[model samples]
Structure formats: C-alpha cells, structure tokens
Target: MSTIYKSEAGGREIQRLYREALDTWPVPAEHLRLPTREGETFVVASGPRNAPPVLLLHGSGANTTMWRDDIPSWSRKFRTYAVDLIGEPGLSAPSRPPLNSDALALWLDDVLDGLGITSAAIVATSLGGWVAVDYAVRRPERVTRLAVLCPGGLGRQTTGWIVKALLLRPFGRWGLRHSARAATGLESPESGPVLDSVVATFMHFNPRTERLPVFPDEALRGLTMPVLVIVGGRDAMFDSHETARRVRQCVPHATVNLLPEVGHAILGQTEPVAEFLRG
Candidate 1:
C-alpha cells in the first residue's frame, strides 16, 4: 500500500502503490507484510489492490521504497511488489550476520508464498540483482520472468572500490555522505528518504562479501526463466561490454542491452524502466 509521506498540492505524482515509489519520483505502491518461513513477516509492496504480479527489489544500501520514482505507472499494468530486504532495513526482520545465500533466497521464496504469489516478473538492480540471480538459480519454479539491471556477481570483473565499500560497511556510509553526486544515477531530493534508508541499511545491515558466497558463472547459466540484462553504458563499476558478454555467456537465452547513458542504478522516470518491465 502506498504510504503517503508528504507532497505539495498539484504534484504530478500519481497515487500508485506506495507514496514513496511514485510521489517520490520513481514509483509508489502500497506496503504489505509477507511472512518468511521463520514466521517473521517481511515488508513488501504490490500494485493497486489488483494488478498483474511483479516483484521489485532495491539496489545496494537501498530498501524497497527506492523504486518510488519508477514503479507507480507500471502498477497500472502490473502488480509491483517492492521488498524491504530482511537484514537491510524497512519492514523486513533482520538476521544476525553470517547469513548464507541459500538461506536468503529460501526466505525470499517463503515471502512470495506468504504473499500468495505463485510467480512474478522480477525487476532488480545492483545488489538486489545479485539476490534475484541467486533466487532464480535456486528456485526457477517461483520466477516467471527476470530483468536484471547492472547486476553484480556476473563473474566478469569486480570493482575493488565496490567490494571494499560493500564489505566494510562504514566506509560505504562515509562515501555516501560525501559522494551523493556519485551515489545514484538519478538526482533528486525526491529520493531523499529512500537514500537515507539506503545509508542506514549500508551501515547496519550491510553484507560481508566473504560471509555470503558470491555467485559463480555456473549459477547464471542455470536460470531457465527468460532473462533480460541491462547495463548502463557509463557504469564505471563494471564495463558494459564485459557485462553483456558475461550475461550472454552465462544465460545463453538472455536478451541483453547496454544503455550508454544510464548508471549502475539504471532506473528512473517511467517510460524507459516500464519498457523493460513490459518486456
């Protein structure tokens, strides 16, 4: 359900699922609680009380609401679910450190089952994309379609800066404070609350790279769902060409596109993001 934060009168923002997703500049939808197998409920969102099901995941340091600017319109055509990753922040319950990849994916699977969603089109970016990839490999039956945006763990090239920041956690927050310009592809205070949440998630719920094993190339090759890989052309973290190559090599059936202008986050506004979701 769309939680109404605050907005000026005559705002262009549309009422979608959560106030953050749309009114916030990306997309907005309502919030819902889905229980994990452990009986802990994870905070997630779905479109208008009734739209085609689609699960949306946030990038690193970000929570489910980060999709605010891009998801409301899509909600008209599909039920968009933005997940607050357990251990990250927001509505999901946290697990103490040392969580494994299989546990994470299985808990996500349980969340979907708790939501009563049999299958969903998954749209994910950054760290969330890594989770999506792992889930697809572990449980293909639950995913109907997958769109990975600048996904990590592609087994091509890993940026030392990213690995350091994600692993250290504290340095990541310091970097966010000073590097707001480089933090996200889209620039707008419309994204402030979400960004703050991201910073918090980074500081507290950050994952230790060494803790959860990174996904191998074999895992990418195993996904049977139709996969769409989108990497920003300007993303310095991972070479777009390398990303495309690795994606093609990993998922033989993947449809790949490299966007020269988009950054690692790669989502904003409606049309471009919606195009991928529609596909």
Candidate 2:
C-alpha cells in the first residue's frame, strides 16, 4: 500500500468512489492531466471555451469533488478549472514537497502554463487558501483576483480538536462520524452525504500533520489584486478572528468576512465568491 493510505484495499475503495463522483460531475467537463514539476496534476475543466479562467482549489484531504455544489453557478460565467492538489486524496500524484519551499508556486506556474492561462481569478479553501495566497504573493501579476475560505497561514493553528478526536477514536465508527462533523462544521441534514464522504475518505487517507508556514506581513502587503477572505468564527482548525485581523491589517483594501456560526468548512457562498470573481 502507498504511505498515503491505511491499506491497499482502503486506497482502492477511495479511488473507486472518487471515480464515481467524477463521472457524475454537475456539468460537462474535460478531465486533463498535466505534467508538472511536482508530478502529474489532475484538473476538471468546464464552461465556455472563451470565458475568463477561474481556478478552484480544495482543502487538504479533498479533491475536485468539493466544488461540485458551486460549479454550476460559477461555470456559467467563467471557464472554471477545479484542480486536484498534488499529494492529496485524488487522482493527482502523491508527491508532497515541503510547503516552506518555492516548489508549490513553481508547480502552479507549470499548471497555469500547461492550461494556456496567463492569469486567472482564484477561489481556494483551507490548505488551498494557503496555496492561493502563496502563489499570489510570489506571482502577484498572474492573479487577477483572490478569494479564500478558512485559509491557513494567517491564523494561529488550533489543536484542541485533535485531542477531542483522539479521545473519541476508541469509540470506533461513532467516534469517527462525530469527529468528522466537529472538524467540518457540517451538522445539517442536507450535509449528510458530504459528511459521509469525509468519513469514508478519512478511513484510508492520511492527512498532512505539519503546520502551515505562516506568510509574513511583508508578503501579504504585496497583494495588490482584489482579495476576499471568509472564515468561520467557530473554526476548529485555525483562529478565524486572527485570520480576519491579519487580512485587514496586512491587506487593508481586502474584504474580510467572519461568519459566527460556521466552522472549518465554510459552504453556501457560491454566489458571493462568484460575484467577487466576476468583479
């Protein structure tokens, strides 16, 4: 079995489910695999051929499936590329390079180049948010606009949930389900399928444990493009308040929204994010 999964059978099961999800993608999409320095990257491209490009990046432990709910609306207005981040639980390669190095940005450069895109608007969440910000900082001229959801780097990473999850692990499936809900903040009945997917993925997927390297204020200050940040007040993974504050303090012109009732997983903002990307 690959080190990224618990066992060979578990990995195969997860891949089977991912394939099923891709087959039912909400819109017509072209599944493209690009050769990058990191490895082969998988992307789901949709919408008009002539529309402006909008890149979508999902958080860690996730793939393009996370964008299914938002794709229909956004794709109508723009050519959208939902990229499966390298090393995550997706069809992409399992090469996880050091986050602190310039490798990720360079890898993104290759992705954009391979797609024939010079610049594009980016909407990213969680770990993907960190990546978007990092790329924007390193290649500000290439990012027309940026919107991040519960992104890391700016906030203080929280670990209380880790202890809670570990304590509940002894309870088995019940514990795992509860842990998924707590971590994702998806407790509504409508989110049952998503929660179930999360549980199934975590059963085999090994998530990254290293803390994200924080972007210095000097780096953030260089983002001249329009920026939007949305974080949940009750986020279990990072301090949302600090993230909001840092965005305001460092990128003074950027928009910041902190939803009091949400958690690490911020959903149902397809319109808001699409509007921002449109502008």
- How good is model 2 by TM-score? 0.98
TM-score of each: 0.73, 0.98
Worst 10 residues of 1 by lDDT: 1-10
lDDT of 1 by residue, 1-279 (tens): 111112322112222233444345444444567667544654546466566788887765456666665665777788777786654444455453243537777788788887787878888887778788888888898888898888766634445445544455455566654343354444566756645654444333334344224566777778888888888876745566777887888788888988877766565535755776676
C-alpha lDDT of all candidate models, in order? 0.63, 0.94
Per-prediction backbone clash count: 28, 0
Candidate 1 local lDDT, residue 123: 83
Error of 2 at 173 (Å): 1.7
Q: After superposition, how far is residue 63 of candidate 1 from its true place, in Å?
A: 1.1
Candidate 2, residues 1-279, lDDT tens digits: the string is 387888889888988999999999999999999999988999999999899999999999899999999999999989999999988899988888899999999999999999999999999999999999999999999999999999999999999889889999999888999998999889899889889989999989999899999999999999999999999999999999999999999999999999999999998999999889988
lDDT of 1: 0.63
